[model samples]
Every structure is written in structure tokens, then in C-alpha cells.
Target: MKYILGIDGGGSKTTAILADETGKILGKGRGGASNYQTIGLENAGQAIKFAAAAAVEQAAENLSVSWADLEGSVAVVAGLAGADRPQDRERLRAALLAQMPVNPIGLRVEHDALVALAAATGNKPGIILIAGTGSIAFGIDRNGRQVRAGGWGPILGDEGSGYFIGRAALTAVLWEYDGRGKPTSLTKRITSYLQVTQPDEIVPLVYQGPLQRPEIARLAEIVLEEAAGGDEVSCRIIADAADHLVKLISAVLSRLDWCEPGIPAAGTGGLLQPENMLWTNIAKALAGTHPQVVFAPPMLPPELGAVLLGREMLDTAVGQEEFIANLRWSIEETSQS
Candidate 1:
């Protein structure tokens, strides 16, 4: 049987999946961050190889296919960070080819957001809000035109994202320490999480170069914890984040698509992952402002969406039953092993 691979290479992590012609996932794998911008060519190549090999290995274990016995393989539709620049994309493409000798027709790449949209709702024309280390909203109109808002990265935009919330927490800490802003629990929570007894230590520790996004974003979780514990300032921070994201979602729905009555909107990224409670607040905020917005369960990993796109382009029709079965299997496999 022919096999295709899809990879979603994000800033913090990489996900790879193996799927058959019917879009049924056979196996899946994950690896560390493969964002070419953060890790460079050598490390990025290694990460991608690690992710792809794991997926292939799992699939081979189930199907009894040696590396030589595979009929076809493809890695088209990688939505990787830093892929916006032509040179960066080229560099990653070259490195990917060097790492894996699959057929030239089998490889492809795109921005991580594009693949996320594809995976979120089968790329059928709707908006997706992604809130992880960064935030972005994109949508396809009924006419197939695409429009995007935000996603300018943490420094410029990414409001309502984990990075944004975390940065806000740090700013609050600074403000409170200097007696310039409202007192907040963030100062204590953040300093404590970093294992520092005093807020003064944060300035030097976080600024010593090599700031980790996930570590910083963990502060956002602390902010949430504080909110849950009834800290008014923390509650306000979470509320503001919800408002910011709701605005972005509304804009995408209106500007990108016809402000139609119903659009197949879905939430994605780490913030919207099922276990994250932030999505509940976001959904509540949206409901108050507009008509009921539909929330979709993420049916496939972004890598699988990339592979599905390739499969559709190549005239492979994955039936609904097969698709659902693969999705369930993939989720179960990940949860169990």
C-alpha cells in the first residue's frame, strides 16, 4: 500500500504522521522544535528526521513494510515557523531532502498555520485561531480567498497567546515591584515558578539570552492559576486575553469570509488543546458578542492535514469512516503509548 507522510513543524514542537491513501493514519511520531529559525539547519534537520523516522517506524511495525518495500512517500505540507522567507524555506527544503531520500514528488512544505487550518476542519473554508507561543487567525471565504490577521510574532502582535499572556505577567511583575501599576499576584507566582525568592532576580535571569518560549509561557498558566484562586488582577488579565482573541476571531470571520450565519470555525494550538481551559473563556466571550460560533474538535494533526492535502491533489478520496477510524486510532495510540 502507498504511504504518505505529513509533518507539522512548529516553533516549540514537531509532529509527524503516516497515513495511507485513504487518509487513515497508520502511525504517528513527535519530536522537538523544528522551526528552522530557532534551531538552524543542522538541528532542524535532525529534529525533522527524528520525527519522520518515528512515524515511519511505527507504521512499518503495523504494516510489515521494510524501508525498501514502501511504494510511495510524501512530506508535502509542512507548516513550519520561519517558512515565510524564501531563503529560509529553501534552506529547510534542501535540508529535508538531504535527510530523507524520498521521491522528489513526495515532499512539500507550507507555513504551520496553513497546515493547521487544513487539519482543523478539512480545509473546507473557515477560520482558525491558533494560540500557542504565537497567535494567528486565518480564514478562507466561500470563494476560496484567504485572509489572515495577527500572527506577527510575540514582539509585535500575538495578543491573547501564551507568550503574550506570559509577557504581560512579567510586565505586571515589573510594574508592581516599581509601584507603577496595580498590585498583582503575578509577581509572586512568576518569581516563585522561576525558583527565585525575589522579583528583582527576574530581570537578569530572563534577559541572560536564550529565553525559552515554553518556560516563559508557563507563566501564563500561573496567571490562570492565580485567577482561579480569585485574584482580581489575574482574572482581569485572563479576561483581557479572551477579549483580544475574540476580537481577532471576529475580524477573521468578517473580513476573510462573508459574515455568513455559520462558519466551520475551530480552535487550535496549545492554548485551544482540549485540556486547556482558556478556550472555555474564549468561547464564552465570543458567544456574548456574536451569533453562536461553532467549535470543532481537532480531527487530525496538522501533519496529517498536509498529507491529506497532497492526497486530495493526487486524487485520493479518504472516506468518512476511514478518516474517523484513523483519527480515533491515532489519538488512542498517542494516549496509550
Candidate 2:
């Protein structure tokens, strides 16, 4: 059996999927954080190995076949966060190869953003704006010329990101405590979310405690909830986040030129869903400047984009409609199970 594997790894969790040559998704698996930049090389490799092995195991269950029946030199592609640099890709490639459960053929390590664009546009010229733990905008033109904006990590940039929202909310809470800012529901919501009663106690926890970046980023959900419930401070925080995200998209779109009808622009990541605060604000904001931008849904998730790249390595054709339908149905069935 000609098998393909796709892996999407980030700071939060890693996902793996198995697909046949026809681009039909067979099974999927998930593992822990595989962002080597934060989790270390060995841990990242092990996480990836665990996810890929689990995917094969799921495929075995789906097909009622043994590992020996499916094992081979599988075509593989891994799109990982914090892997944009060549040295990072090479290092991860070496580490992943060492710990792989099966022999890998044409195993390519790719930046997660590029695969996200493919997921959004199917290799067509377009733009993808991702705003999860971090935010970035990447755009490609007709001639394959690409431009990227934002994604500078938290200390420097990562504006319009979950971390940004969380950080801003925390600041707003402190400001309210000091009477320097307007009183809003965020102060109470944030204090409860952080498991602290007094706002003054937040300083010690934020500075010296075990509060990591991801933990702080998780607070973005709380902020979003408050925004949805009509908290003034939360609403402003989310609106500011949307503005920053729009700036990133605008900077990228400014550098590239795509013809009329509309440019295919897609939003991914947990915080970038349709009708959400950021998505709604971003769409409204972009409509004026980039009127020709068409908001499009992703044809496939980012991991499947990796799968598509793997299929390309084999120089084969896949029936797009059949594969897409099968993939969607299999995903729904497996998710329900």
C-alpha cells in the first residue's frame, strides 16, 4: 500500500494523519508539544514519533490490518511551528529521522505557515492569517513570490496574537485595580481565571511563579468570552488585537500584488474562527482597504496540506473531489467515534 504521513506540530500539541495515495485521509493521532524551540529537540522528536505511531495504529484499526501489512518507506512531510529557518528544519529533520517508527522516504520538514497557506488555498496564490498563540500573515502571488509579516515571538512582536490579548487583559485588570483605567468585568474574570482573589497578588504570580507563556496565552479565551458577553475592556482588547492583526495582513498584502475578482484570504488558528471577535473585526477592517480580499474556508486543514506535499513527492494525481469528500466524512466519523 502506498502510504503518506503528515504531521503538524506546534507549541501546544502535535497532530499526525495517515492518508492513501488518492489523498483519502485514513486516520489521525495527536501528541504533546513538539515545538523544539521551546520543548527541546529530544522531546520534540519523541512527541512527533508518538503522534506518527499513533496515526499508523489508528489506520491499522480502521483497515483491520497489521503493522506489517502497512509498513514501508512512507512519504512524509512535517510542518512545524518555529521551523522557518533552514537550520531549524535540518536539525528537526535529523532528530525526527533518528526516532521515526518506520522507514521514511522524502521526509521534508516545512514551516507550519507555508503548509497553512496550502491548506487554505490548495497551492494557489493567496494569503493566510494565523492568530493563535502567535499571529502572522503570509501571502503568495501568481509567480510564487511570497511575503510575511509579524510572527516575531512575544518579546518583540506577535501582535494580534492570543498572548497579546492575554497580556493586554492582564494589564487592563491591573490598571483597573489602580484606578487608572475603567472598571470592567475583565478584572473579576481575570482574577478568577488566575485563581487569585486580590488583584495585588497577581504581580508575584506573573513575575516569579510557574506561569509560562502558554499558560498566559490560555487566558485569551477568558478575554474572548468576556468580549462576547459585552465587557467594555475586553471588547476594546479584542478590537485592538484585530487591528494589529489587520496591520500584519495589510503589510503583507501591500508587498504583493494579486489580480481582481478577489484575493483568497483565509484565517486559521483557535482565535481566528468565523464570526468571532477578531475575525469579525478583521473582516470589517479589511473591507475598506483591501476590498478585493475574499475570505475563503480552508479546503483542507494544515496537516493535510503536508499530506498533499508528500503526495507531490511521489508525482501522482489525486481526485480532488473524491479525496475531499472522503476526508471530510472520515474526519466526522472518526471524531464521533
Candidate 3:
């Protein structure tokens, strides 16, 4: 039997999907963080191996198939969060090959942003804005050209992302504590969330060791909470974040140059989770800029977009029902585990 493997390697975690030639999913696996930037090139290969092996083993057990019999897989696309630079992609690809057993078929690595884009629109044209550890806008214009904006990472860019917002909140907390800014609830909430009584405690945590993206991003919730409770400081921060996020879409839309109404744009990642006001604000801002732009709620997680895009790379058509069913199966299986 033939098979294809698709992987989505995020900053926090990695997902692996095993599917048959016809797009029927056999199994999937969850593994440790595979962001090359976070985990380093030396460890990326191991991370991918662990994640891929877990999925392969699960699929083997569930389908009663042997690893040796697993035919050469095709188009093993990996959409990674930090594979922005050409060097990063090269490193990730090299790492995948070095770690995995040699297969006759090949693997393809791409920006996590592009995978999210493909996931949102399938083979059709559309735009995808992802706000997670980082923020980036990716789209396929009507002419089939791909354009990307603002995936420069948290240090320099990543505006409107959870990490950015979190960092902003943390700074604000320090500001409030120093009497440089108005007293806001974030000053207390952030300290409490980290189990500390003061901002000084976080200085060591943020600088001492490896800073976790999601952990830092958790502060974004505090920012949102303070804003919800009517803190003007928090509101202004969120509003600014929303504005920064709009810039991502605007950059992509400018490249796409949509001359007509009904061009689809979708939101994804941590910021777009249900009930997320950050995402709502972004949509509202986009509306103000492009009155005719259409918004499609992301139907599947961006990782699943990596899987589906892998299938598409083979020139295969995955029907909506089957695609969603595969996603449901993966989610259910993961949940049970």
C-alpha cells in the first residue's frame, strides 16, 4: 500500500499525519517542539524523527501494517513556524533527511505561514494571516503568485502575534510597577500568573534560560482581561496590536491587488481561536481598509493545512467531506491518547 506523511512543526509542538493514497487518514502522532529557531538545528532532526516515528507506529498498529511494508511516501510537506530564512529551510530539510530513513520519494519544507494559506484556500486563491508565536501574512494572488509579509520573528517583527502582545504586556507591567505608566491590572495579573509577587522576578525568568513562546504568550490573556475590565492601557495595547495585525493583511492584499469584491481572507493560529477579540479587531480593521474583502473562518487547524497541502502537491484532490473527516479522526485519536 502507498502512503504519504505530512507534518506541521510549530514552535510549541509538532503534528504528524499518515494518509493513504486516496487521502484517507490512517493515523497521526504528536511530538515535541520542532521550531528550528527554538530547538536549534542540532535537535530539529531528532524532533522530526520522534514525531514522525510516533505517527508511523500508531498507523502501523491501527491499520495492522508493517513499517517495512509502508511504501515510499510522497510530498511530505512540513510547515514550520521559524523556517522563514532560506538558511532555516535548508537546515530543516537537511535535518529531516539526516534523521529519517532514506525513502525513494521526497520531503518538502515550507513556511508555516504558507501552509496556513494553502489550508485556508486549498488550491484556490486566497489570503491567510497567522497570529501565534509570530505573525505573518501569506497569499496566492489571482495570477498564482505567492506573497508574504511580516514573518520576521518576535525580536524584530512578529507584530500582532501572541508573543508580541505578551511582550508588550510584560513591558507595560514593568512600566506600571516603575510608576512610569498608569496602574493597570496587568501589573498584578502578570506577576500572579508567573507565581511571583513582583515584576523583578520575571527578569530572571525571561532572561535566565530558554524563553517559551507559549508561556510568554499567556500574558496576552492578561492583557485582554485587563482590557475587558475597562483598563484603558490594556485597550490601547490591544487596539495597537489589532492595527499591527492589519498591516500584515494589508501587505498581502496590496500584492494580490484584488480588483473586485469577494476576495477571501482568513485568520488562523493562537490569535484566531474562538472568542478571541484580537481576531475580531483584526477583521474589523481589515474591513475598514478593504471594503470588498471577504472573510472565511478557517475550517481546520493550520497544521491540517500542511497535511492537505502535502496531498495537493501530488496533484490529488481531497474532497471537503473526506478532508474534514481525516481532521476529525486525527483530533479524536489524539484526544483519546
lDDT winner:
2
lDDT of 2 by residue, 161-251 (tens): 9899988888998999899999989888878878899888888888999667777788899988999999999999999999899899889
Give me the overall lDDT of model 3: 0.76
**Location of the lowest summed lDDT over 10 successive residues in candidate 1:** 66-75
In the order shown, the candidates' Cα RMSDs to the true structure are 2.7, 1.9, 2.7
Name the weakest run of 10 consecutive residues (lDDT summed) in model 2. 64-73
Q: How accurate is candidate 2 locally (lDDT)?
A: 0.84
RMSD of 1: 2.7
lDDT of each: 0.74, 0.84, 0.76
The better-scoring model by lDDT among 1 and 2 is 2
The best-first sequence of candidates by lDDT reads 2, 3, 1
> What TM-scores do the predictions have?
0.88, 0.93, 0.88
**Model 1 segments beyond 4 Å from truth?**
71-75, 85-95, 209-211, 273-277
Which is the leading candidate under TM-score?
A: 2
Q: Quick one: how many clashes does candidate 1 have?
A: 3
Candidate 2 segments whose C-alpha is farther than 4 A from its true place: 65-73
